[model samples]
Target: MSNTFSSPLAGRSTGDRLILGLAILLSLVMLLPVLWVIAMSLKDNAALMANPNSVFFPPYELTNYLNIFATSSVFRWIANSLIVSVSMTVGVLVLSSLAGYGFARLNFPGRDVLFVIVLFGLAVPEQAVVVARHQIFSLLKWHNTYQGLILPGLSSAFGVFLMTQFFRAIPKELDEAALLDNASRFRIFWKVLLPLTLPAQATLGIFTFLNAWNDYFWPLISATRKEMYTLTVGMASTQTNFAQSEGLGYLMAQAVFAGAPILIVYLFFQKYIVTAVSGAAQR
Candidate 1:
């Protein structure tokens, strides 16, 4: 008789195999809901309502997705979201980088105390300040404007903290060497230190963009007009009184559509995300 070969997992301990199996089981458990949603989106609303099990059957159609584009102001909302998210991300990066460099590299009066004040901002919940913020924006006539949405998010305490930590982790030798070349402080920061903090910037920028993109609460109050609504607010407006039972497929399609951009961004930046997480863990 021919010799039998061992499976690839044959050498792993029983505990290791059990752990691997559990990991796979958890992954499938998480994945099943997403798959179910996609399936529901592809099914006709009538079929889904008549028999929820119909998602497993074939004859899937894209009619529900088509209806979203045909009827809604989704493209306008998408544009609004992109503008706000991109503008906010750029602003946060610039301000955070400058503030971080100051805190990390320079000596100034009351610097530590000022930094502590910024840290305190992290503990203060946004809900605590929403009323005051809305009133101020109202006074400025900034309601229903892009600036209203973008400006508030730019004061990112977490972004400042992350950048400051990353900057401090860098050796001072680089700054000294740059100074030896007569480089200005701004030049050193722009040319030398900023590039070195790519991982932190990537992490910060991705999170900032995602948060701005999905910002419902602020935009809901700020963008009362249909034309000014962001994707999140716009999608919510599309729901009918009977959306749960009558327009289930359409609802799922809207979710998939609204989330598609975020998913694409994550796919492209996932390597950077992994690098940032792993680097943070090591430190």
Candidate 2:
């Protein structure tokens, strides 16, 4: 009986160990690309080209990072990215939240129909409208301008939808109570509802910021001048330059520079994003 019991216990322990090992294996697989990029960023062009397999094992060089910042307009690109992203985030938060609240709470004629039409905007691919958007920008004389880059992404249909859902989740009794206290609808929104929906707002802000920051194709198409280039566009330029020179380290360093800001932002807002996403999922 003791032998029989020991045999079953040992089998179960082995199965648990196997599952754990597989999970760790999967995690390492997912991490490989990021590790490879970091390794490549530290390698010199000669070392990278001569012994590509050995690049992963340190004896690292700092020249790639030093050379990239010294020679490239990386800082300018980062500044442009920050300006556009912050402007876009602020605009989306204010406009989308107001629009969402209006659709959720304030009654007006044809509101539902109008909102349904707005929902269709979310379904439309942005690429499909790029040509028309370019034409409009040209007509308005806004091309290669910060206003041109920032204005187009200021209002997002998905943001409106997200905020509307969160706003609707608030109890109607709270609104009524505020009104009984002689509060205006705007006051109620600012003082009461906004505080309760901080998580959702944070989630929306991060999403909007990330979209604007990492936007490549639109900014590339719209901002024809090098001075107007965002990080994504700048990185593309760096890739072209490095490809001509065959400088793999410099290319990887530029990629790291482009990706770092986004990583930092995500780290800061990750908790709020997870909370808001989980709440939405449950709802």
Root-mean-square deviation per candidate:
3.2, 5.4
Q: Report lDDT per candidate.
A: 0.92, 0.87
TM-score of 1: 0.92
lDDT of 2 at 20: 77
| Backbone clash total, candidate 2 | 0
Which residue pairs in model 2 clash with each other? none
Instruction: Estimate, for each residue in 87-193, the C-alpha lDDT of model 2 and write its tens digit.
Output: 99999999988998998888999999999998999999999899999999999999999999999998699989889889999898999999999999999999988
The residue ranges of model 1 lying beyond 4 angstroms of the native Cα positions read 1-21
Give the residue spans of candidate 2 off by over 4 A.
1-25, 241-245
TM-score of model 2 vs. true structure = 0.89
